[model samples]
Target: MAPNFSDLVEEARLSLQALVDYGDQLFNPTVRLGVTGLSRAGKTVFITALIHGLLRGGRFPVFEAFATGRIARARLAPQPDDAVPRFAYESHVRTLVEERQWPHSTVDISELRLVIDYQRPNGADRTLTLDIVDYPGEWLLDLPLLAKSYQEWSAESLKLSRQGPRLPLAAAWHAHLATLDPRGRADEQETLTAAGLFTDYLRACRDERFAMSLLPPGRFLMPGGLAGSPALTFAPLDVPADGSAPDGSLWAMMARRYEAYKDVVVRPFFRDHFARLDRQIVLVDALAAFNAGPEALHDLQAALAGILDCFRVGRRTFFASLLRPRIDRILFAATKADHLHHASHDRLEAILKRMVDRAVTQAAFAGAEVDVVALAAVRATREVRMRRGHEQLPSIVGTPLAGEVANGEAFDGSTEVATFPGDLPTQPDGLFSVPADSGSFKGLSHFKGLSHGSADQADYRFLRFRPPQLDNDGGDTPYLPHIRLDRALQFLIGDRLT
Candidate 1:
């Protein structure tokens, strides 16, 4: 007799507990953080940096205070292969350190766990477990379409085909669908032709790499299965005018299938896996949009609109917030801030915040709390001095790799400087407070113009980002990273921390 799926799930769940149980309870809270981003956003770097921070026991200066605050202790422990399995942080670290190269971007869903022992404010020793999971950004768009059907999907896709360069391919598929007799006995040959056409349309979408807000997983459209099978066959029809209009129009059949896809595929995954998440970090690549031309910007907006819609849980005013089980706090972070000079880091965050603010507001109106943070997952450069006509500013200097060049262009952020240079100044609190020696920081100036990568190679540049500054009420801070971590813990998992 074979083991039932439930039994297997139970065993896996039990195995995960051992891994989850490694941290000290009072100081460390069991928290789950979701890492998500658009196709080329630096989620990998963010995750890698986070793992490095934890592994080094918060030795990294970036998170030094956070490691000590509310967290009296921190450590790395063995993780289990249960659940989705831990993220291969060590493997990524080796790639970055041993090979002196950045880790390749993620292609599929992956998971990693970091167990930290900490001391909470109340003087209790506790263990905090951070479970990080990553998935392809492309797959995220499909969440909305889980509610859509084959016919609906097909019709919508068909419409997309008419616009841009996608029209000819879609027209061919539409012509094929037009020939097939929907009312006639389902002819395998006709169905096969339609599926083939559908597959072609999907392929075209993939090839164009259009930032579509919704797409069924590519695998589903081009399944390695029998042709004309029920899985590949979809009938997308429109909603009828009459309430009782059940006469199987292509729309009705498609609608039914769409609902089935949701019930069978999307809903189960959310209910079983995603809903359990406690924290989420959404990574955005704003630079990509500014460079992709107007269409890409529109696509970015559309994608943001779609992503925000997911957290819009309920309809009612009072009861809805209480009833909707959201992942609590969502962090919308601009990834790869490392690529730009420090001077423009806030501007990048502001740009992203401006771009997604409306959608975020709408999501909040529907009942989810969201905040934006600017982050660089990997640190690629060091602060440098720049001077221009007696004005100096804090800037980063590094020998950028050849591949870091964008759009077949090469511009260096380096400069020849005199022997005596002033020490790096503190980050400005408010916008536009020029340091007294802005004139001396000549080598630290940022580029004024925007640069973008072409379609062929995305995620090629090393992103340098400005880290978020914490508001201190003039207290002597012994540990910086621990304080940030504690604040984050308080906001995200404090209730569970104690």
Candidate 2:
């Protein structure tokens, strides 16, 4: 019999491994970054901009030596390691260049890898491989819950259904499930029926997309066709009452599925990928929360608390080859600072600091450090002079949608429009009662506004993220020119010292 294709491929791998081992031993550090945020948080734009800034080795005010701070050098060349995944850089680049438009919202988890070469402060040259993973912001919330049993998780979900803001869909699903007799024989029909209603609620979430940040199976929802997959069909855990056994009940079956989900989906992702992170960058859209209703505001706080629990470093395993959880620094960046003016950027940063102050304080026991910053990935609008005497001010010269009116004229979408304030702060103590303004939302309009902007250019769009920062002794201080990647690098991984 002829040698099979699989056999040929296995033979090739052996041959390649032998040749590749001949090179000088190269050290590889897998820095897994989790770019997390609420629904509209500007993760895609921030990542895209970070990649662009790193690639462009020139003077950048928001980046350290790119302009002044430190005398340094930079360059971007083809990455060597085939295992390092490639970011959709070319496609994203084309979205701006070819389409002359913002790219569609990042709907699922996409991985990108790049090798950035630079000379350290000690004059030694090195190549740092960055393995970047971008996933839907909402899925991050599900990470912590993976450790819980289905009964425990289901009970919590049931509790949350009655209390959390705007969880009508989840509430209705639970109400329908209550009608079924849990103690009866496994009625596949009734179970499937209840599951169908719950699935509908999940589907509704996908359809609106921007309404609430509480997304279900976030990665799966974006593609829509994955609903049939077993991984996406998990039911919330339902704990038994009377302190008695409910094994062999419908709830038990669903609980089993939930366990499978945690074992098959969540554990591997964390142990193999997430548990080894060296750095984290959490993107926050403080302004967006202030603009949303009280319910959203409350939900945001609960969501943050849940996500931060993961960073509190648990026990370390010897056999895993994992680095002891040394991720000491965490940067909570308030993205889309360009939407406001320079004066208000600090205020925006301050607001974020205030909002997450409790979260940081709680996680401090794990050696995690925290900082808040206001940033813009792409500086779409520039502040120009309103009068002859003053200096140029930040302004945008684009259409609202192709044909929308602003200050009259034919609205050619070419005239420069002023962008005031600067950065936006987190909601102040009394922001809820601040009274409605023209831009404030009354009902569902808030969700509409969130879905309507680009990274830096959008009139009203911000992103939230929570990726681990690179851990190093010197990676604690905040970076100067806080908007760019070089600044992020200084704060997240500056031990290289060059």
lDDT of each: 0.52, 0.52
Q: Estimated TM-score per prediction?
A: 0.65, 0.71
Candidate 2, overall lDDT? 0.52
Given candidate 2, what's the lDDT at residue 270? 54
| Candidate 1 lDDT by residue in tens digits, 419-487 | 111221133222123232132322223323332332233333233322223234454321122212223
Q: Model 1: how far is 45 from its true place, Å?
A: 2.4
User: What would the per-residue lDDT of candidate 2 be over residues 1-498, giving only the tens digit for each residue?
Assistant: 356675366445543432332222245533446665765567776776666555644335544434443434334335434643545776765564344455566665566665655566566666666656665556666676555556566666666555534366566777877677655566666666666676666555434222444544453455344555555555553555323337787766666666666655565555444554545677776556555554545455656666676663422233112223334566777776655556667766765666677888876665566666777655444444342235343432323334443223233434444433323333444433433322343333322222222334443432221121212335322111224445665565454334
Candidates' RMSD to native: 11.1, 10.6
Residue 31, candidate 2: Cα error in Å is 4.0
Q: Which run of 10 residues does model 1 get worst, by summed lDDT?
A: 416-425
Cand. 1 TM to true fold: 0.65
Segments in model 2 whose C-alpha atoms lie over 4 Å from true places? 1-30, 68-85, 199-211, 214-226, 237-247, 312-325, 384-398, 401-427, 431-486, 495-497
